[model samples]
Target: MAQVLEFKLPDLGEGLTEAEIVRWLVQVGDVVAIDQPVVEVETAKAMVEVPCPYGGVVTARFGEEGAELPVGAPLLTVAVGASAADTPGPGEVPARDGRQDPPASVNGNSRPAAADAPGGAAEGSGNVLVGYGTGTAPARRRRVRPAAPATPASSAPPARPSPVPPAPAPTVAAVPGQDASRGEGPVPVISPLVRRLARENGLDLRELHGSGPDGLILRADVEYALRAAAAQGRTAQAQAVVAAAPAVAEPQPAVPASAVAPGGTRVPLKGVRGAVADKLSRSRREIPDATCWVDADATELMRARAAMNASGGPKISLLALLARICTAALARFPELNSTVDTAAREVVRLDHVHLGFAAQTERGLVVPVVRDAHTRDAEGLTAEMARLTEAARTGTLTPAQLTGGTFTLNNYGVFGVDGSTPIINHPEAAMLGVGRIVPKPWVHEGELAVRQVVQLSLTFDHRVCDGGTAGGFLRYVADCVEQPAVLLRSL
Candidate 1:
């Protein structure tokens, strides 16, 4: 006997609520091993390969590739303890009377067999995502069959429980301003993203019909309704303007057709792009920030780096040296290394520095944080940054590696640009921006000289520190650039 088990998508941590299916690794009727990678999904954070905990034959899969599924949605079903002859063929399902039948069962029961049952098929690897366990299976809901016409007592057959349970019907929540007379129940929406879209656009979910299974409202449905409504409104407004126009109006200059019907490619802000948009928007909205910049003569710093590499076992990167200087400067001006707690009305200074560096990848801009950066030396920081850069380029960074930074270092110089007032990474107090180091005319030791010059900008939250502190930090960094020995005093 085979026991059919349902496997729902587990919660990927770090406050992620949903994921878009990128690809499926297994197909129906494929025999799978425990903890095998089943599907690849892209969340707001990174690309992840989700593994199944059960070892069995895949019975069915839920969402198609490129479809977004909320957490806890069914990913697939597996039939455990089934013989090779019992497994259905690829893309085939057992049906009766031209209708699909419920899953097969074990021992006349719809639920999964106990973990200690024969063959121990119900036992799982217990390696699901955080907060999800496979120790015990959840109880199945009983399927509610429709009532049949009453028959004579002599002709009625003996009643027995169904072999497998049916999936529960979609539930809805009552929508405000809904007409009670229509007898419609609450709106059937399961995705928070769908609900947020409808709410933000003031579109009533009750007015639109869902095209998903069980009439569950999806994001596409709300988007289609909003688009149709906009087109209708535009049509009505155009008609009204034409009717109000005077019959003998003076002729006006002709407008370009391009202006009348604007056309261009529309790229959706989603996944990594969407997440970056939300964070940058929030930073601009919540932080009252200011920027200060200074030009530093970096001839000495470059020479020092060359000398170190020439004599070193492991080559030290220029970014790592700059990071070392930042940590040292923060130690002197600790106020810049803290965040503001608006709710508590306190400027909470952090005890340790988690330094984040901006790395642009094919996916988008990402900041990978290095934990306890204040404790690492230049070589260590270089190694860690290289590892993170590779991970970011390959789209394998975890959510934890992408968040929790107390300060940020953004080196836009690699782009061959000179100064920029960078927006602070929110919740953190400040960001340091470094620009290209080029040879330019400078007054050194009271004489004209050509030296390597780099521009450095510091953007700080005005609430945490005033212009005096920000200037001092930038000045210190400039001093270190001109004379690398100044950093040894702090060390």
Candidate 2:
């Protein structure tokens, strides 16, 4: 006997609620082993391959690729205790009463009815996602068939045919111009993507009739409704223009070019892009942040990097040197390396430095955190940073790698620009921005000389420290950049 088990999208951690199906690894009727990655999904944080807990034959897949499904929504169904030979062929399912029933397709994919095996127990891998674990399959409640009323033929009443034929029951699709408010209960919607589309376009879900099973609203139905509404609006506008035309012509005021132009391309802020927008927006809204900048002569820092690379060892990156300075400065000015706890009305200072650096990728801007940065030397920092940068570029960074930062070091200089007051990565107290090092005339030891100069800016949460503390931290970082020997005292 084969038992069908359902697998859902698991919690990917870090408060992520949903994910978009990127690709499916297995299809209907394919055999799978325990812990095999069944599907690849892109969450707001990163791209992840989700694994199945049961070893079985895949019976159905829930959503199509590119469809967004909430956590805990069904991802697929599997028939456990069945071999490849025992598994029914496509479009056929083993019935509960020992018969084969034709399978039905949902969203253009075949799905068989799920049922548990009688008196058969199946084991599963205990590891899935956080908060979900393996256990004995719960018994499924069976529906009891009601018995027909029994009566003697003589006692039974004879039925007569009615003069008028009976009317058909109302369907899921409501009649046009019908009052949506009059309908009872919740609207029939299963996919969150459909709801989001309707909400974004300001379309009321109640007003449109669904074309799916039992009047369930599908994505196609919502799109059709939106198109109809847009066409209706355009027609009304044309009618109004004709109605306003006058017999005696009066010159109309000139419309602005922006007003007359067609709408531009609209790129949805979602996934990584959406997450960045949300975090940056919250930082601006909640934290009272201030920025301070200073120009430092980086001739010595650059020379030190060159000297290290000249010696035969793993090449030291300029970013690693800056990160070393940041960690040392944070050690002295611990106030800048903490976060403000708004609810408790307190400033929570972190002991360890999980330093995050900004990396630009094809997807969007992502910050990958280097754990215990304070404990690592220049060489260690360089290796870890290189690994994280490669991961970010490949879109293989995990959620854990992207979060839990105490401070951020943003090297926007790679963009070839001189300086920018970077927006602080939120929840974290501060962010240090580094500009390009270029030759500039400066007073060096009482003489006007051309030296390598770089601009460094620090943006801090004002609640954590005052301007004097912020200025002191920036000055220390600048000193280290100018005279690499200044870092020796901390070491």
Candidate 3:
């Protein structure tokens, strides 16, 4: 006989409490090796493949694809030490909740088995997740089935009727116009995606009936309801338009912006998008920010970069040169290299610089930070920036790489925009926005000439410094852009 071991969802790092099931690699009755990735999950931070620690036959899988499960929820069960006789067939799993169901041949497929096992605790890999640890497994409680109802000993048992009518299945339909989401009864939704979908479409989960077993709501049910509601809306709009028109020939009904297209795609903002939204909102709410900008002749900076590459072993990038200037500027204006501690009511000036730069990828905008950026030279900054940009593009950036910065350098110039009032990354004191360096007419040695001109904008938290300090920092950056040799003085 095989001893079934239950595995719960492991906690991913960075205080993540839940993950959406993206895909499952194994099925019931399939044998798996220890530490093999059994499922892929998407958290708020990243997509990760979760490995199972036990090498055994898969006896059950708890959640379906697209379901979001919290940490410590049962993921699957593995049957260890199984022989040919004990090997379950495809699509067959043990009964759940310690219920003593019949054999697989008699019971339906994917049924959960009793929760108890006779064998001792199973061993697992020492691989660490945030909250999960390798130690003695928790004891499983065996469920005792209630004894069959006792028959009268003094008299013969009642005879069965000619035919027994089956019990009516439970009805999930609520009274007309009754909202289930606000009711006292629990909703039968197990997936966060389903809840999000319903919420976004303004569909009340409690008012709708689920099509799955035991009144469980599935994604398909919500989609179907949305389609039906859309059709009804369109029809009502057409009727209203027809009633208002005077002529027999009907005019095309004006489309409302809120109406969903026939096959429009709706992407959920739960992962990177959600995190970005929350951060940007917090920055706007908490930071009293101000922006100061200046246009500078970048002819010298451009030439200096060309000269460095001309004589160089490792090629230098304009962004790296600008970053070098940023570090130099922050050194002079240490107030901009600090964060405000609201609880303590103090402006905390950091000694070291962890510079975050904005990078646009296919997923979204992400900031990858360079540790101790003030210590590294231009070449080192170039290499680290290249590595981080590639990692961000490939969606492989760790949370640590994405966070922890005292200042941010945003080169929105690559996007072809002249300038923007860049939002300061919250908790950080300031951000420097660089626009495109293009040819513009400027006075050179008392004569008009076309020079490489760039716009530099500084967005800083007003709470930390006044306008004079902010203007000084912007002027220093502008000076460095006009005369690259000015940066060497700080170097």
Q: What lDDT would each prediction earn against the true structure?
A: 0.72, 0.73, 0.70
Q: Which model scores highest in lDDT?
A: 2
Which residue pairs show backbone clashes in model 3? 94-111, 94-112, 94-113, 95-112, 95-113, 96-112, 180-206
On TM-score, the candidate that comes out on top is 1
lDDT of 2 by residue, 1-491 (tens): 87778897888999998887888898767899999999988888988889999999876566666656678766777789887677655545344443333333323222222333222111111111111112222222222222222333422222212335622212222333354442443454545667789889987666654544334566656765665555545555655666797453433323333335456665766678888999999999998999999999999999999999999899999999999999999999999999988889999989999999999999889999999999999999999999999999988899999999999999999998888887889899999999998999999999999999999999999999999999999999999999999999978
RMSD of each: 12.3, 12.4, 12.5
The Cα error of candidate 1 at residue 144, in Å, is: 19
Count: clashes, candidate 2:
0
lDDT of 3 by residue, 1-491 (tens): 56778787887877877777777898766788899889877667656678998888776565566656667666676777774346555433323354333212101111122222222111111111111111212223332222222223322121212235622212223243444332443345535557779889887776555545434456656765565556555656666777898454433333333343555777866667777888889999999999999999999988999999999599998999999999999999999999999999999999999999999998789899999999999999999999999988876777778778899999999999999997789889899999999999999999999999999999999999999999999999999999988887888
**Would you list the rank order by lDDT, best first?**
2, 1, 3
Query: Predicted candidate 1: what Cα RMSD to the true structure?
Result: 12.3
Off by over 4 Å in 3: 1-7, 23-38, 51-65, 75-90, 94-188, 191-213, 217-266
Candidate 1 wrongly placed segments (more than 4 Å): 82-85, 96-191, 200-204, 210-262
Instruction: Kindly list the per-residue Cα lDDT of model 1 for residues 42-111, writing each as its tens digit.
Output: 8888878899998888765655666566677667777787644576555333432432233332111122
Model 2 lDDT, full chain set: 0.73
